[model samples]
Structures are given as structure tokens and as C-alpha cells.
Target: MTDIATKPDSIIAVERWNTFWGARDLEGMKTVAADDFIQWHATVRKNLTKDEEFDMLVEALKVMQITFKNICLTPMNNDTVLQQCVADIAIEGAGTRNDVPFAMVFHTRGQKITKCEEYMDGMSLPPIEFTPQD
Candidate 1:
């Protein structure tokens, strides 16, 4: 990881976003995300609004712990960044998966993430059965 002080605000925002996820701090996630935030998942072929994404994260966190390693960040411009990392996901009752390749393009505005384009290997994910809430 590079020195936080030397990093750009866009990178800082991205780091904070990932940090919030690892810490399972939903509020922190909200703090860094713009009100109009949208995430497009290439592998899943879906677009998720901020609330929708948060809901999914909350559900996933109930059954798994995720960590990131070998992270690489590239600045696309003043407000855009590309991040690539190996996600280490450990699912309860399913064992751990290491080095699952993941990548995302983040667009930021004033320290808040406005949009994210995500890519991942769908097959690398462990299946989890999520029961619908009543």
C-alpha cells in the first residue's frame, strides 16, 4: 500500500471504501458513497444503486469475510481511478478462497464515490443461498 498522505483524494476515497468493507462498517460505506452512486457489475451484468449495493453487501457479510491483497491502483484522470486486487473471501461452512481476481473502475467527486464499474470471476465466488426476507 502506498503512503496515504501521498495519495490522491480519489485513491483515498477508494481506500476508505475498501477499508469500510473489511471493517463491516456500513455507515462508513455510506459516508464515502455519493447519493447517486451506482455500481455496474460486468460479470453479473447488473447495475446496482447505492442502496441496492449496500443491501447486497449487508447480506453477503452475514456469511463471509472478505480481504484484499496485491492491490494496484491507476489514476485514470483527476476524478477516475482503476483498481485491481486479489480478493480473499472466506465463507462460513465453505472454506476460504484466495487470490480471486477482482477489478473496479471508480469515479469520484469531492471524496465521494459517484460510480463504480466492477469486474470479477463469477466462478470464483462460492455459492451462498440467501433466503428472502418476509
Candidate 2:
């Protein structure tokens, strides 16, 4: 694990994000997020607030065996981190499972994550159309 104080703020933010998800710690996620944090997902149509993202994660964790590996995190600048990972997902929906690729860009403010935009290779049922309101 990389120490936050020793690395750049972007790295710290991404590390915290990974840590919380890896442990499925919803409360720990809140601690590292700004009050107005928002996340956009490639699979989802709408942008999600911090609380909403956590709620989504809870549901996903229940049906999927998700694991992130081969994470390559790069600090795009002082406030942004770009990360790519292979997400091994075993989704038990109607008895189907698959591994997927994932990538994200995280923006940080101080020690908290202000925004995260994620890209995933999967299909969401009902076919969502992304409409950016922000």
C-alpha cells in the first residue's frame, strides 16, 4: 500500500478509492470523498453522487465476485489520477459470469475525491442512454 502523505494528492486519492472498494467499506469511502463528490459510470446513464455510488456498489457486491488487478495508476497532474485495471467479475445474474476491463479518472481536492469517471466493459440491462447534465 502506498502512503498518502508520501505520494502526490492524486495518487493518495486513487489509493483511498481502491482501498475502500477492495474492502467494500462504504463508510471508509465517505471519509475520503468530498461532500459534493460525484461519479459517472460508463454502464450507468446518470451521474451518481457519493452516497448513490456507495449504494450502487452495495448492490453490485452482492451479486458479483469483483476483484481489481494489474492496476496502473498515473498522476496526470497534481489533482488528477488515471488508472486502468482488469476487473475479474463473476456476475451471478440468470447464471452468467464474465471478466471485464475497467478504467477511471479521479480528481481530488486536498485529501478527498471530488469526482471520478469510470469506464467498464459490460452491458447494463434495459440499455441506458447517457445524458450529461453537468
Candidate 3:
């Protein structure tokens, strides 16, 4: 079995999860999530399984056309990473654009992410419409 950190799989998984704006490869996103992974969505105002949260994110992305463009990552020891991202987010139907700042802490076991805690400005960016796709 190949390890996640030193291998390509880990890198890909991290990208999919951390940069999960809308255009990220969703199929690829599955590889990094643990079977019972739990994610707390700051924007959603809920705590859900990885699968559940991912679906919500994707739906919002489709209608919103948002993306996290320039992201800076900082390694906080081997098991954790601190990230700051500036997203060029747009609401497709509304024809609006927002430059949002977000921060998250990632905890990885080997290559797979086990826990992710995200923080963002609630006042600047209101909760996005996360209704699932029909």
C-alpha cells in the first residue's frame, strides 16, 4: 500500500477537499475522505458526513459558479496544515461577485484527511444557497 503524503493520491485528495469550490473533481474528492469522515460546514451551519457535505457544496457551486483561486497553505506540523484562501466567488443567477477570505485547519492521517475545521467571515459572505441538485 502506498502512503498518502509522499504519494500522488494524497496531494490530489487534499486539493479536492480543501479547494472544493465547485469545479474541483468530485470523483477524485472521494479518494481522500474516510468512510465515516465528518465535516463541519461553516457556510452550511451544520455538521454532516463527508458524502453529505460534499453533495451540498457541489449543488451550491453549480448555481453559484464559485471558485477558490489563490490559496496559501502553511504546514502546522506533519499531521496538520493551516490554510488561508482568497476566493473569487460568484453567484451565477444573481450576477454577483465576492472576494472572500477563509481559513481552515486540516488534520491528516498519513495521506487521508481525518478532520477539517474551517473559519470564514460570516458578515462578509452570507450562507450560500446549498440546496442539493435534483
**Candidate number of the best TM-score:** 1
Deviation of model 2 at 123, angstroms: 3.0
Better of 1 and 2 by TM-score: 1
Q: Compose the digit string of candidate 2's lDDT tens values, residues 1-134.
A: 65655898778777887899798887888899899999988775468988777777777667666678999998887598889987766656434334467888888998789999889855633232222334
Ranked by TM-score, the better of candidates 1 and 3 is 1
Q: What ranking emerges by TM-score with the best candidate at the front? A: 1, 2, 3
Ranking by lDDT: 1, 2, 3
Model 2: lowest-lDDT 10 consecutive positions? 124-133
* Candidate 3 weakest ten by summed lDDT: 125-134
Tens-digit per-residue lDDT, 1-134, candidate 3: 34555554334456667554344666656667777667765655556778786787677657766566567766666667777886666676555556688787777775677767777765565445664323
* Each prediction's whole-model lDDT (CA): 0.85, 0.76, 0.65
Alpha-carbon lDDT of model 1: 0.85
Q: Cα-based RMSD of the predictions, in order?
A: 3.0, 4.0, 4.9
> What is the model-wide C-alpha lDDT for candidate 3?
0.65
Which candidate leads in lDDT? Answer: 1
